[model samples]
Target: MHQLIASPHNGAFLVARPGARAGMRIPRALYEQVASIAESGAPLPPWLLEGARTAWDLDLAGLTMRDTVLVRPETGLGYGRATYEINKGCNFNCEHCYLAERRFEGLPWVGKARLLRLLRDAGVLWLQFTGGEPLIDRDFMDAYTFAHRSGMLIEILTNGSRLHRPEVIALLRELPPYKVTVSLYGATPDSFDSLTRRKGAFKLVERGLAAAREAGLPLELALIFTRHNAHEVDAMRAVADRYGAARTEYGTISPTYSGTPEPLAAQAPGFLDKTGVFQGCPAGHTFFHVDPHGLATMCKVGRENPVDLMAEGLDGLLRLPGIADAQMLRTGGCGGCQLSGTCRVCRPLAKAYQEAKAPLNTYCRHGNEEA
Candidate 1:
């Protein structure tokens, strides 16, 4: 599937296929040329033929495409979905959480309301509410309601611990999110508590999931596989099935957002399977991440440089110094490596390697081959 993404190098837009190692930069003139022909049901001109393969694998000659979202352009940014981390303080501190020590000292409710208005006006259609746990955020309901009323589809990324709260359940019942994803730390109390390092959190999650289902909210379950809970994969899926969860996903642990390597040691056996190619990343392009305190950057993983939303207004935050220059990192040895073919390490993950300086054998399947 082709996705329209803003070029990080410049504010210009690029049409990129999912998982493409590189994106072809399309000039504005070229886009208009293709669009004009597409609308008129006329064949592409001869000059356009030479650029077709390099620009994108488009059948320019046939020119049957219509209603191109890329051509419509939103705020001249081309962003469809935006994820906001409302809060960073989580009740259950999972041992392998990426945002272990990350903190959020952000705007107050009034300022947040303004930011929501800005996002709505800027044409952000799908808004994702995420955090240490969005359910526990003090102004979550307000933000959720505001985003929904602003004509944005809302999705919540949260652990189910607070889902059982009366007000939280009521909010879900009143204005349901597009979907709610509950991260299941473990299936059993002992394993769950061990992973979160919190006593009696498993019960809260159980109650929260039940409450979500009771509220007629669409539910999804994601089980994070670590050395602590790899054995519970099947059991967790069964539990999700019983709850009638719409989807269940299993993901392996990655380096912490703090740039620490400690959590990498807790990976499950064979976690680093040779998945696929190590295409750069789509951080600032397709979707951008905003941490609490409005530190908007490429993504949460390799948050090396962030543009302060408060300092640099969203008017052109994406084109600011730190942001506009931010690209999928190809740092150090990765610039020209023989193992590039099988390397699944992306820019953010590569930053983790630079931080720890630990050999990739511990975390990468391709790196293991070299070892």
Candidate 2:
């Protein structure tokens, strides 16, 4: 398979570091899929290093990456869903962290400089930063600086603990974010802290949020419907009201994490409200997730090896991954299920169905359900 060992960036060859350990070996077929994304002949960085197979380096030029191997690109240019684990780890041990058990073990800080360069070079317009808690990133300014300079709009999905402090708040007002998506587990620090397993997280998060508002950044509130917090969602709304962020609005949790402790099955049939106007969960096809390991997939739901990203040059993320190719959650459970409105359909779980796996049956009854 053809591999571009390194691409020159800013007139400097970005060769893999001297001790660059080999990435998960990509199959020939998968490598071809990635090639199609870079068919436009976009000047690419040498992100891949090839192992000597058959004693020769395969030339990658003119090798079209197949569209079938990549995730579907977003319809409108200048706007697409982008999620990055900015910190590669989180400080809080939130009760629902799917990556919590493996948080500390993901890839180390890859430097915001390279991440933003890749995103800009790939033509990404909007970016979503998620983590166990992204505020804790020491090199966060570097990332913010790069994304802003590259004309990328930022959306921070944060826990709000860091934004509450007056000093942090003052600094936030000085360098306002384009938008903030705060995940509010509970309004009061007592409930929020208990749910997050951190004693003063609630207070810190709340204060950090006040700081963001005091700075006038547009803010959106994301409420995950869990048994522990569903009972007081209105209180969470009250927290939003205090910020005068009426223009910003609501969000839902993903049902894929229901395997944990949530009583949605007993609370309501669906976590989504019928009046809501959002379409089905279309993340994988519309958004891409690159793990700290650099394994690119259609969305955060996926748990498979390099899907079609190697050959694609990071731009062909617009096509859909084939049904048989995904290692994800079940489909019978979500193929035609009724929870689209409540739970953000887990692409990983949906991959299960696309690949003909057994339905991992689950029932979440959080909030009010129509049927």
Candidate 3:
């Protein structure tokens, strides 16, 4: 396997090691030089030799470009990042899950391979594989290996249920991911199992975490706070500390992607922090999301005009910027609100709250002040 990946990212060139967070950005001329060296099997350049050692502790003293560097061909398409939902199936039945229905379905292996290629053609360098639990998917290893070999830095968003499995751990150990983000429900079995509605869920996840840590896998723990386990916030952080992994906390909850109100009931009281001002995001312009069936959208929340990648191919993505712009517009219920200038919720999110008939205080500034 190549030790490093050299690719064009959003019009700039970057050299990153597999399973590493840090990378070195190189100029276009240097990228071209590296590509030529790799193609001709030239010796490692002195600059790269020293830079790789300094950045990632990687030594290229005896390796040629062909053995150490994988030069990804440049695609003029501007996109640099994407999230692909491998499958929506999950073993856990968490009440706070944003999916109204956790359906166990997705495209077959052939379609998945094609979609990854299309993403590569569109210049996607940072790819995240998410799901109800991506590790449980039947073809996840195949798809992950394919994408990794294609020069995309991969991240897996998982529930950590399968991290204890020998086969899963072995695969990940062999082909490391940039990051494996596991969601932590609670600190203890009672809270964790109760929240997930699974009798042995906590034990499984605990085992998974231990196994991942032992293997030195790049791991991040997402500590999720819900009414069911809000009291265990400190304990959950302790769990992350014990594992020696990076961590993040999530307190706010949202309605289901399809506008179902069920999940909002799990929101922990006093945990909802006021959202920040709505600065425009580069959703469709620089990054996009893909559902199981190869349907591409601007982001996870704004699923309005989707591009069917399977049917329309990469050219279909041409319509996404317009679709993203349309979805972000302050139309419908938000058409003429006086607070639009300072509104924290974007139009698509506000629309979901409206569809769910959510209490105004949950999402609206006016409702917050009234409360």
Candidate 4:
């Protein structure tokens, strides 16, 4: 059965099945209205009801048994959301970072404004501000204020190291984000600081989280997986609950975006799903990732090639030659891969062909097994 849910961060998303791996974002009010109508057992116009169901790829008329959802949010490209990495420079030196090459240097305010304008013009409703740490940007507030005034719902992904500062907290209080997602590396200062490699960084994260909560901002916590902190997984979740986070996101570490195995040594056991089969990646179609340098790609990982957003405008980049080739899923070498069912590898990662033309075996349960 299909159900509409408000993610812990309060975004409206629809799940086709009870435990579907992915959910489609939808307009919150519309989803609630549909659910309320369903609960009341009052029949609405058939076309209206069917429209929501067919919003994605699940055509109820054609695939009667396959569950589907239709997202009709107010914002998005032809689709409703976009992720912008505000800056690549980060305060922490985590051993598992994919963008280790990112220095604090990034696009200037004018460049950022241009990018934001492009997204707004594309009809995007949800704008996620991510970073090495977005708060560190000298002009973060300026960019943020612009996006907020542009009428886009804003989301934030941060390390929570700087939220304790009065100025940072004050800015958030003035223009609250739709949600503030903090990455939890460990539960205790020792465990956490070890991963971050900075003394007392954990305390800063704690203060940051507390400051956000005290400010009454929507908050969620995600546990970043690493072999160094595997023992503290449960305790980290407990910390998330203590903060009353709306949702808790956690996942295993994967190879670097460069397809290097250097970081694989930090991966925990049981990271990938063996039972799942390959499904098409949603990057470029339902989602896209843009970095601090104005380089756009399907996702953050395996970024061998990217559309230069500054050199070529959004329209020009989207229309560039070989655009389709860059986004296509590469599974020919996977031995009729079942890993796609639960695999984290996408078109770019697959194209990188790490681990001998298969997804990184460290993250893939079937990486070493024959099909």
Candidate 5:
């Protein structure tokens, strides 16, 4: 019998017969949704499934992974990726905002019960704190505290606006993998202010970055690639070099958001480089997101195959348009390429680019080219 067994704590499902793994197949609807919108109505082309199988590392003919290991964290991209919109609204507003309607909305939070259940059911080992700026959320501690309690690794993407706050400092002091990824627009205020369109951001970000490093938090100085800062790559690296153990990664911005999509460059089609395999992109399968509006999506962009989390629990979300069957969908740009699981191709920027493009054209995509 085929029954979908899911956990409230680890967001995954096991579909199998009594004891066999060879006959299992993830539902077909998953493929239909993620199969290029151009191919949505057509039969899935052969390359798609071949690529998906290759990316998922499934032995189509032999079933290399045992049925019992289907939901094991070690066996798959279990609890793959999650973007927690701690602070749903933004203040800097350079451009391309889907949440423009929420510009002045208060920083709401995910309930403690809901969050713990998400962590436990999704097996969400990797949690990303995002939003208007994760730092600005009143429940930043509440979210961080839950991640810590769940014993998951975490990374935070921020505009670097509030690192100086005492409570923000306290969370970093106690969290694990307390990675602070800052989107530095330029080396100085003149150019930086132009990108974020906010005054005094340059000084605040610099000081915030320093405070994070001094506290010994793992720091990744992220440079938002754009025509404006294209020439300042060296200066950006110089900033990274100062931090002995900190990293400096570079990436291009995507102009996919419907409003003011292009911050400093035009949109790139495919959003992905179309050159590598993410080795795995088991997003909706492992981890997923529930936006402020209570929509549950695989990633942050919230456009593709979005399942309203409020209407449906985790199990129902997986059955939505884009994720019905877990195994049949392609991991998009990184599904069948050589990089496989080592690339960060399914990031928020990538998602935005795919959904529209502005966020990607103006964000970072470097670090761990492999998974």
Candidate 6:
């Protein structure tokens, strides 16, 4: 197992540890030198040895390049980030889940290995594993280990129900992830269980959080506020603080990825935050999302014109940028809207709202006016 990874990120070179949040950006000359040293089976340079110790408290003193460092080859692909849904299966049935269906279907282990290799070949370094609940997937551990060994910094988006399991904790301890982001539904059992429609759900979450905290895992909390638990927002914050994990609050609820409007009913009345101006994102150009069955899309929202990675391989991603640009055009209901200049939502998101027949005030400046 390598302790450090040196990879080309976008147009730059970065040296990072597997589980660390911070990385050292090195010059092109230094990256080349490091690569040469790895090829020559020489010891790591003194600068990297001392820097790793000071920056991440990692001691790489006498380790040679072959044993200490994994030099990731540049694939010439611009992609640097990706999100893969291991499976759209969750142990809980949260009313506001963005996935309309929670089917426990995905590629077999052999196909999953092929997909991971394809992602690595596509120059994906920052990878996130998400799902209805990723941890519930039977092959999650195997897939995660493969990705981590492939030199990708991984972040797991989970519901925290299974974090208390000894096997999960042991694997996470052995090969730490960059982050484990858990969704906080409610602070108390009654509210949480009621919201998830799963009895004893809160206890499991609490136990999971406690175990993760004790294990010193890199954890974060996504406080999902809905009508079901809006009153407990403060309590949720307190829970996050208690665990010493970073927290982010999400109040607005969007329709499912399939454009189903049922999830919108759970939105908290006055808790919706105002979205900022529409700056562009590098969804398909530099980042992309892959579903459980190896279908790659621009992002989680714009699921149109997917590239079947399993069938078409890494070359299929060449179609993504064009598909992404086409999806972002201000067409359909937003085609002639003059206010699109200042529209907060992107075209893909707006299309979902339009498909759901969501109230204009929720996503448009026109309020209740007809489109």
The whole-model C-alpha lDDT of candidate 3 against the native structure comes to: 0.89
Write down the RMSD of candidate 2 (Cα, Å): 14.5
Candidate that scores best on lDDT: 6
Each model's lDDT comes to 0.67, 0.50, 0.89, 0.65, 0.53, 0.90
For all predicted structures, in order, the TM-scores are 0.75, 0.60, 0.96, 0.73, 0.61, 0.96
| Residue lDDT tens for model 2, 1-371 | 12322222222222211112222334444444444454553433233313322223433343433311122222232224467776556767666554524354444445346555556555454577777577677766566655654444566778777766565455444444557778777777676776677888777776767667767767777765555566677877787788766433232333332133332222222344333333344455545666554455656656454444434545544444442234334344455656555653344644433343322333233234345
- lDDT for 242 (candidate 3): 96
Q: What is the lDDT of residue 88 in candidate 6?
A: 92
Backbone N/Cα/C clashes per model: 0, 31, 0, 11, 38, 0
lDDT of 6 by residue, 256-300 (tens): 877889889888888766667787889999999999999999999
Better of 3 and 4 by TM-score: 3
Candidate 2 positional error at 11, Å: 29
| TM-score of model 3 vs. true structure | 0.96
Which segments of candidate 4 are over 4 A away from where they belong? 1-79, 271-278, 320-325, 331-344, 351-360, 366-371
Tens-digit lDDT track for model 4 on 12-62? 444222212233454555456554444343444344346536643333443
Query: Of 4 and 5, which scores higher on lDDT?
Result: 4
Minimum summed lDDT over a 10-residue window in model 2 is located at 11-20
- Judge candidate 5 against the unseen true structure and give its global Cα lDDT, from 0 to 1: 0.53
What does candidate 3's lDDT look like per residue over 31-67, in tens digits?
Answer: 9999887865688889899999999998789887887
The worst-scoring run of ten residues by lDDT in candidate 1 lies at 1-10
TM-score between candidate 2 and the true structure: 0.60
The segments of candidate 1 whose C-alpha lies over 4 angstroms from its true place after superposition are 1-74, 100-104, 320-326, 367-371
Q: State the lDDT at 7 in candidate 5.
A: 19
